[model samples]
Target: MFLTQTVPRQREIIEVLFRNGWGYMRKLLTGGKPEDPQLPTPAVLKKIFIDLGPVYIKLGQLLSTRPDILSSAYIEELSTLQDEVPPVDWSEVEVLIRKQLKRPLEETCKYLNPVPVA
Candidate 1:
């Protein structure tokens, strides 16, 4: 387990930016467009993540580990935030795994059971 520090000041800054940016964009998109039916929920979440910037997203993710800080409702909603971030390509994953494990991917997992029930 790892212990991490919280920079509440940074979090507050990011929250302010995210809230303001989100409000501005939301209003622009939704204003006078009552028939637009709104953007998809996942789209809204991803947009919020983008507007909030990286620090808030990281903080939210970290906060999910601490139930004592945020209420369960907020945590649940924060957990739903998709960071609008693309994953490393599969080729990159292979390269990183090989580099970290100092072995070919096949060699590292060759003898491992396909399914290990915990």
Candidate 2:
């Protein structure tokens, strides 16, 4: 019932939940039962957040700050959640840099590395 046209990402979210073995969330999403809520293991939860992308990573980071809600183990694990973005191609980044500078990339910096450090 909840998996309607309006919520297009519902299916994807459910799939991720299922893949991560988050039984409680899967049940909640698919409207299986109204049982007590339960969370997966801390590491599993972190993996789920990672699979869900930036928004959920941010949510996990925020959740990590809440010592009252999560146990130390969960907080510790979630605290390490970093946004794992794929590296952008140097060509794309060079173009953006050129646009921002309103000039050639060479004119701005003498020795800019193509590879990202961070």
Candidate 3:
């Protein structure tokens, strides 16, 4: 993850891990009752994935396919993983495309939609 992510995103991931640890600690300290309602089991996993972002969602998908490695219940929950990304503004996509291709998007494609393919 550190290899693939920019510095700020790596920091964000570590912060999420700390948040999860604190969540568990709060549960333990209060004997399972908390100010906020406790998350359901699947909700906790989903929260973790949503915080971590797309790469982790892809990792969860890969893990979900390994029935021998995970119990049926866990596999079932993980199979629900989605990237949960909002659509990027086309301007950002154009920037990314230009950076990768080292040319303007118009130069590379005869036709390009401002909206992403989804």
Candidate 4:
């Protein structure tokens, strides 16, 4: 399905996989099977997720919770995958919130904090 769709980040994702030495993933994406399938090291897998950006970082975080699927080493490594993005200014966030709300911000809440805690 991904191969059929025109995903904007497809090329970047593939490049990151290749750069991280994830040959198994590259083969899977290109509809090929490796003679000897090999997974990347836990650290390398974490690096791949980090290089792929926020979405992949979140996926890795989710995967970290599944002990049945991933080994302790992988879970340990993925658990540390955090999105290191800079916080958006409150002004920009307020504008987006205002656009989403049916009424004014003042009407919706008595006192809404502009600063982001998380």
Which number leads on TM-score? 2
Model 1 — which ten-residue stretch has the worst lDDT? 34-43
lDDT of 4 by residue, 1-118 (tens): 8765857587787888899888798788788966677778999988887777667778998998999998999988888775443455788778888999967999988988877676
Candidate 3 positional error at 32, Å: 20
What local lDDT score does residue 104 receive in model 2, on the 0 to 100 scale? Answer: 81
Better of 1 and 3 by TM-score: 3
The best-first sequence of candidates by lDDT reads 2, 4, 3, 1
lDDT tens digits, residue span 36-93, model 2? 8888999999988888776888899899999999999999999887444445678978
Query: Which segments of candidate 4 are over 4 A away from where they belong?
Result: 1-5, 26-33, 82-118
Give the clash count for model 1. 0
Better of 1 and 4 by lDDT: 4
- Residue-level lDDT tens digits of model 3 in 5-106: 688876686677567665754565557766655443554565577668667777777877889986777678878774444555678777878899997767
Poorest stretch of ten by lDDT in candidate 4: 80-89
- Give the clashing residue pairs of candidate 1, or none: none
RMSD of each: 11.6, 6.2, 6.7, 5.2
Cα miss at 39, model 1 (Å)? 24
Give the alpha-carbon lDDT of every model.
0.54, 0.82, 0.68, 0.81
Task: Look at candidate 4 and tell me the lDDT of residue 62.
Answer: 93
Q: Residue 28 of model 1: what lDDT?
A: 50
Q: For model 3, how many clashes?
A: 0
TM-score for each model? 0.31, 0.62, 0.55, 0.59
